[model samples]
Target: MNNLGFFKNPTQITYGMGAANQLREIIDAQGFKNVLIITDGGIVKTGLIDQLTRQLDGIHYAIFDETKPNPTVTNCDDAMLALKQINADVVVAMGGGSSIDVAKAVCLLATNGGSIAGYEGIDTCSNDLLPLVAIPTTAGTASEVTTFTVITDEERQYKLTVGGIRLAPKWALVDPLVTKSLPSHITASTGLDALVHALESYTSKMATPISKTLAREAIRKISSHLRQAVYNGDNMVARDNMLMGSLLAGLAFNNTRLGNCHALSHPVSAIYGVPHGVANSVLIPHVMEFNSLAVPELFSDIAEDMGENLESLTLMDRAVAAVDAVKKLSKDIGIPTTFAEFKVDDSQIDRMAKDAMLSGNIAANPRITTYEDVVALYRKSIGGALVEVV
Candidate 1:
């Protein structure tokens, strides 16, 4: 009870089936004359961009749809160039996490005047970014409401985290209808990413009562609705619940931060080019198992939230059940169960582990970690085995 904590959420979040319809009014209220819509090619192909533009009739805007699956520094540079060329007074992020992250980086660099690499650590940027409006089409990566953004550095092969409260969007329009069209695999991967966010935040060393409350609710919501959202993509109820879960997880982690799973997963995506959600999905269970040793009570609570029947179990058994439940959900949702499935090999583990150690998130991990522990976790994940941490 000696922990002192602080929470701040500046983004005004609106959630519902047609939340995107408010985009024009939100923009108009802010009096942004020129707008840049940052997104990916996939979202454009889905006609979501077209729908957004139609709704934003009479608003002067340009689209930069070159954002890649794992957004790179080059993507941010190109998008910033586009923003300047268009004289965009505001940025509208119109896709998933990649799109939102790209917009945040571009906005930060536009005002701050430097490469993203210069702002890799927490609170490195000294200036406020341009106004940003985020519309998340996926149910995970709640970048819309977060103080952090991840962008890849291709030359160094690392995912650099840029963080500060100034990076949070001014507004978040979370429309569940947009997620109804997500492919089953994308739904599963993103939903599980949100789940990991909640779990990690709940057990983080920085966890506060507020963060834990939101994290536990997020876990419960995701566990109840993620399967239905994955298998029945068009179910609005499931989609809405998943969206809320993701947003809550974002709020929780935005304050408490995450744990080793996120720290390790960032490197995996940066090196192997694995999708962020997929990388997180594959590593979450193993990280949970490794971390359970330090926070058995928290893990036991997670087990109950995830619907594990722990009535007759000891605290340690309940912790094991939590990890098992995560693995089961991931498998049932068709997430790749092993790092090997993503083409990661032992040869790359050492490099990834070293990069993972540099992550600011490692500081918040419930268990204090070492390079050897990270290497071991990487090997166990690749082998699809959950063994006791060495």
Candidate 2:
């Protein structure tokens, strides 16, 4: 293990059941006059926007709710236009990862005076972004506290990953109550996404003591509470635990980066338009099976955290049990195990593998992955074949 490690999380996170009610006060304390609310049509339709507006009765704000599930550069450009038109001093993102990612792109463009494409890689943006306050209505992505934003480029047919400490939100208001109204599928997909994040980060080559601690706890919380949260959306305790799990997973990945699961899932979402969480959910077990060859001890630790009884198992067996546990949990939560469920076929596997290899995340994977390895994993994922790890 490397003795030298680095950790950085500049976002001030406030988490609780009713933490969102303090939004107005938080904004006031930040001394912001005009706030631009970036979210999606679903959030507006659900009356969450109205509820927030009511809380900020005297605050000056404008709403831009055109964000899509997989946000595009056009979405960021439109939001930037809205921010400029309203002359907002601060930006508030009040939805899932999409809204927050759009807001991050808009904020980056607002101050940096350029298109989102220019800031695609790590530390590409030198200027400080406009102050951003993220309030998550879903328990996944944890875009609220992370330093990464994924914006799709429709013209190029790719998802652009923007990273740097400069991209971290100024504040994260995590209210589990906000996730209480999420649909079951959303809960299941997002919760499983959180689980994948924990598992991938725990075994990442960049994993540190700090990140591993957070990742292990996140795995435990998601394993114990994700099902209850999905089955009973009204269960505040489960919702709270899932939200905390998501946040901790975000923190882990934010510091240490992720692994093959995320590296591969990005291309699937970019090409197939699959929801990020669902794609990750489907690919995680397959990636785990492949990655365990490089990190069996870490996978064994994950098996224990996932509630697997590995009493008499060898390290390799325990690692396989971890993959099995993830598969079982994903199936129990109604996440499709095969890419065929999303209508993906083998035609695009080669191109997707190439794109997946381009992700910086591939370098952080515990295993030294090749283009051929990625192609095999993609095939295994699409065929729903649980190949044994050598």
lDDT of candidate 1 over 1-390, digit per residue (tens): 546588889999998889999998988788878999999888999999998999667778999999999999998999999999999989999988999999999889888998997898888988899999999999899999999999999999989998988999999999998888888988988899999999999999999988999999999999999999999998889999999999999999999989999999998998888888888888888898899999999999999999999988999999999999988998899998876667887777878888999987899999999988998889888883333432
Candidate 1: where are CA atoms >4 Å away? Answer: 2-4, 384-390
- Would you estimate the TM-scores of all the predictions? 0.96, 0.97
TM-score of 1: 0.96
Cα-lDDT of candidate 2? 0.90
Residue 261 in model 1: lDDT: 92
Clashing pairs in 2: none
Evaluate candidate 1 by giving its C-alpha RMSD to the native, one decimal: 2.4
